[model samples]
Target: MIIENFSSEKRENKLNQLSAEFVVAGGGIAGVCAAITAARKGVKTILIQDRPVLGGNASSEVRLWVLGATSHMGNNNRWSREGGVMDEILIENLYKNREGNAVIFDTILLDKVMQEENITLMLNTAVSAVQKADEKSIEAVWAFNSQNSTHYKIDAPLFCDATGDGLVAFQAGAPFRIGAEAKEEFGELFAPDEAYGHLLGHSMYFYSKKTDEPVKYKAPSYALKEIEKIPRFRVIRKEHKGCNFWWFEYGGRRDTIHETEEIKYELWKVIYGVWDYIKNSGNFEDVDNMTLEWVGNVPGKRESRRFEGLYMMKQQDVIGQTEFEDAVAHGGWALDLHPADGVYSELSGCTQWHSKGVYHIPYRSFVSKGIDNLLLAGRIISASHVAFGSTRVMATCGVGAQAVGMAAAVCKELGVQPADLMEVTNLKKLQNELNLTGQSIPNIPIRPESNLLTQARVTASSALTLSTIPFDGKWKKLNVSSAQLLPFEANTAYAFKVQVNASEKTTLEVQLRKSHNDKNYSPEVILESQVIEVGAGEQTVDFKFESSVADQQYAFVTFMANPALEIKCSEKRITGVLSVFNGENDKVSNKGKQTPPQGIGVDEFEFWIPERRPEGENIAMEISPAIEAFDVSNIGNGFVRPWGTANAWVADLSDTKPTLKMEWDSEQPLSEIRLFLDTDYDHALESVQFGHPEEVIPFCLQNYTIKDLNGQVLFQQSDNYQTINAFKFEEGFSTKGLLIETEHPSSDVPAAIFEVVCL
Candidate 1:
């Protein structure tokens, strides 16, 4: 496993400077994700990649689909919510590339690096040499980009080697192990009896589509004669339709550069031969049009030089045999091995060994053991051959990136090197940050809920006293009973009592409900009780109740003391309809409806009572339509109208006659009124109003508005106007026969109200 430098020429031409807080080498998935994470944490970061594009193996040149653990597995499950940067990339590409699956890979990787304002991407740049002032710390590095024929000397407090090749560790003189370790070292069951000269090979991926039309094919220009003797040259079913990565067999045994060159030439020949066999070889004739969609220019290397981190992960660690205090990531993939060379050669064949559930990955595996500042990510992390076999996948590599970036930020913030930051406290902080961002970490068991009580207090006023108690525990079962002991009941109606020490005469209204779901339903019964005020201290107040309770139901007790000492009974019902629409086309129609009402064209119905109304009550009609994509033809014109304007009004039904009661002792109450529609195309109110007679309140209007002070008579005919005022304003507003106006004149209206506000 020897790597030749090839040249000593300094390709870096730029001045050396200390700028970024962190420097990330390699523009692959791991590197880019690392840069993104670091930048998101408010760190000034720089990303350096030898390739022009950000994505390394999954780039267009090397088309590889990113794979995580099995869809159903836990611990090893893919937690994509860790929304620092990678999540953003996936979402952007998922929306942009609807036709091309591979495009998603490229788009996601590029977008992450591009969107981060704190991250600087240096593409087509390769690190030439490491500048270290101490045995463990890297002061800066010299980098050269062949594309620009220039050099750059970058200085940073933290450096990451996401290059998959572990180049930084190689240059920094890190103590890294390349080949398989002796069995005595790790004691892994899968390890060879002794160290052996064997390594997994790389592959050049290509995609093909089978069509209906007939077509001829030829083998790749680099195909070898030995390929004809291979037995596994076949296509397998994949997730995508009409697309397969089946023709990927090359760069094994022989020198990668030399073999890849040869395989490139032979692939075309192999493809044609395979297609010919399927079409004309008597056994198969249905397959005629085989289309080649993509071919990899760069070989997808599986095994390569691995950096030696402070801790070398072994297969035992993956078998759940070891626990690490500094665990930053978890791996669960099986031990999959690909032969080193030759078709089905004894040592170069594919084999797999499954392990137990989840394994811990230590932070030491990220930073180079010999060099202090350089942190390695991706498949090149410090691990034995067998261990690397289980963690080499893209998803695992992304996890490694997250760990390294988080560690780098921690190091930068604490003024410590990555190696030193591997302490338990620092690592825990890193793990917390990763978990907060949604990355999956090894689970540490947590005790069930205890210490249920959070806080409790009572607020007293002359008229009314309100007491609120907060509980942290999840409510399992609740009951309310009195000494006039109401028996504790579950999911049934019951009256409860509390002993109170009162100083003066007072009346109490007792109710029970859960905090979160409390306001949702009205209590079956409200117990009325009286208490005499005490000088001080505690007092027991008993409440009596009659019960015919149902089974399997639960209830909590709540008590309210009437400040005014008045008795009253009432019932209120809240109702509203949800509308749906096509989000993509802006089509207004009831379709897919969501809770809290979300969809392309959905609207929510809401009601509000204002304190300023005469009855110290306010009534509001609201239509909250999703307008993120709504098209308003004209600011003041083309406004959507209420279903029916004349019948929408807020009034006090408590009066002898519901004569538009607009005043209340507590607050100003609005009376009955009708929403009017002016036929003049220019004067359609975006929102209609029907509150206090003096206030021509607007309802459900777009935010924009226009004015018609010029008084231009656009419509002279009286038939164009509609006056609505048929319903009564009650204690609670109610609607019947209310027809929403969905259409309005196309002309510009004076103002379009997006929402209604009653003050």
Candidate 2:
């Protein structure tokens, strides 16, 4: 061992200075998406995280499931799963870790960030100080890593604060609000009063495992022994663990940021106390073999400081379903708020108010109002408290941050401030760029001027004429009302014939319904009704509706609740086709129907949700005239996902080698081609806990090949399982005609694609 001389001066940590085109703080889903999107756009980026791993609340450290607009498929937002980089991550996780192992999720996030060569990732680093260049611009940021005892000075032209708590915005003197605004502030009738609590709180989770041998548990001295104090303690059972205790929360009344430690301790007291009750109170069975597996140290935070931006989203913006011209993202989770007293409160754990459909999130809400170089993201972006209730979920946050990331890239390219992109000329550019990546803005189709395919003639080898879905699957009981969503081409009336078995003589009521707003799945408008006379035993019910649809839309062939009958289901599953049931999903607080209080400023509608696969089979029916919307011409319609109608080109199931051909008058130079296929956007790919049934969505294309005029293969991919498959060819080639051959993922499902673009 070598001896060291004593130093007179105080020891200083090592200092380092780094620079990039863009900088992002926090490594949650929002921050990860932001940095990944920016880096993918060729912007030199730096991503700093205070933790060792990414995913923030969704990390193994916190263990909260990743959910957003889809809301566990428990709400009326059908086919509303987030897209772009957020979709990429969720789908990748579903493919690789459908079991939802939290540790595996952590690896996926890390792998994605590490794969980006443009991203400089700094883990276990915290932003401790801000250096402003002027009154409204950030010069640099000062962050320190305790793990290495190093201080860093990171400089970038643009900075995004996705740190949930708005640390960067807070330090830069940006305007922000901490608690709920009064009802009069935004005309939000859903705003909470003082007694109802203003801010959402923090939560912690723990996992328990059962062993063959008996296991014993010992409670610490600080454990909460008085379990009866918690009002919902009786709801806990031996089978429940981890996210089952999402309501085990605290610290809404206290400072969520500064008192996080105190809140964590309180959560610990509750967790150990509950485990003690299950192990020692003699209230649960087979608990002697159960032992605590993992407990989250850092609490999963819900709400904190919300930064002010160019425009703040209010309750009306969400409830009214406003479509902003500068719409960059969407939100559909209910306006969910919790009681201030948390677990101790006698009131319900949460109050969720849903809208009629998913609402647009404007780009104005992402740019800071004061700071020119600063961009806001995640739950901290501008929004009133009542609106924050819907936008604060992790998946919504991820997509919002993705929009912000793309905006930062555009700002860098145009040499302008973040707010400057709001102009009509610039806003469309941003929206088009996002759409190119398969991020859909509701009601906004890709511009014809931006896609070259719109000018070419598109034709398919064979298109599907869907007249029937044979009754080769299961016979589902009519425990609740069920409906089959059928896409109609235009103002056409269609008749349906369905097979059903009745236990007793009963009149089966059939109604044709549609959404008042064509784009939404909420069926509120009844077009026609028929009460059919049926006798006991299996029989066919014929429904003929004379009224024609006003436009091309999905009409719900609904069978009212009649417990005496069982309807047949089809084994075949197709893209943009589903069977929904008006039922309750207790996990998401949908009690069959939503009947809110008179003055809550919300809609009352029945929740029609599709069951998870292996159970959500399509209803077997025969149509008089087949729907012809699945034509080759649909490939250039500009819409990427199903909108008001089935905006997809589906080949006949018998066509084993489905081919699409595109030809131009003369030779055209091309370098890139993007294929937007069907990946069942309706399924909510929750990051953890809730395991998925299939590794790959059945509608996705498994293999495909692109050919030139000479019949030479230009590009080919096998085992493809994503919604978007983009291929780029260096040293571009000239082709007068292009042909695409696709293989269906399975025999029962037909080959389908939404859009194809050549650049």
Instruction: Name the top TM-score candidate.
Output: 2
Model 2 Cα lDDT, one tens digit per residue, 1-759: 998699999988899999999999999999999999999999999999999999999999998988999988888888899988999999999899999989999999999999999999999999999999999899999999999999999999999999999999999999999988887777888875542334778899999989899998999998999998999998998888788999998999999999999999999999999999999999887788999999899999999899999999999999889989999999999999898889888989999888878999999999999999999989998999889999999999999999999998999999998999998999999998888887788888888888888888888889988899888889999989999987876678888889999999998899888988888888888888899999999988888888767988887889999999999999998888889999888878899899999987999988898999878999999988888878887898888888887789999989979999999998888889999988888999999998999888888987999998678999999998888899987775778889999887787899998999888
Candidate 1 differs from the real structure by a C-alpha RMSD in angstroms, to one decimal, of: 22.3
Task: Assess candidate 1 and give its TM-score to the true structure.
Answer: 0.54
Q: Score each candidate by Cα lDDT.
A: 0.48, 0.90
Any idea what lDDT model 1 has? 0.48
Cα TM-score per model: 0.54, 0.99
- Report the alpha-carbon TM-score of model 2 versus the true structure: 0.99
lDDT per residue (tens digit) for residues 1-759 in model 1: 997576878553555454689999888888988888888789999999988787776677676654433211211111112222443343344334423456555665776678889998898888888888787777888898888777788888788888876777777777766567767777766777788655666665556677788776554444333434556543322222221432244444554433556655444444445544454455554456766666556666676687777888987786543578887776655566676653334332455443323467888888787776788999989888888887887666777788888888888788888877767777767776675453535443111111010011111111101111111112111111111101122333332223343334544444432211121111223333333333333334444334333422222233343333322111110111111111111011111221122321112221110111121111111111111111121111211121111111211112121111111123222223222222111111111011122112222111211111233221122112221211224454322111122221221111122111111
For candidate 1, the clash count comes to 83
lDDT of 2 at 551: 84
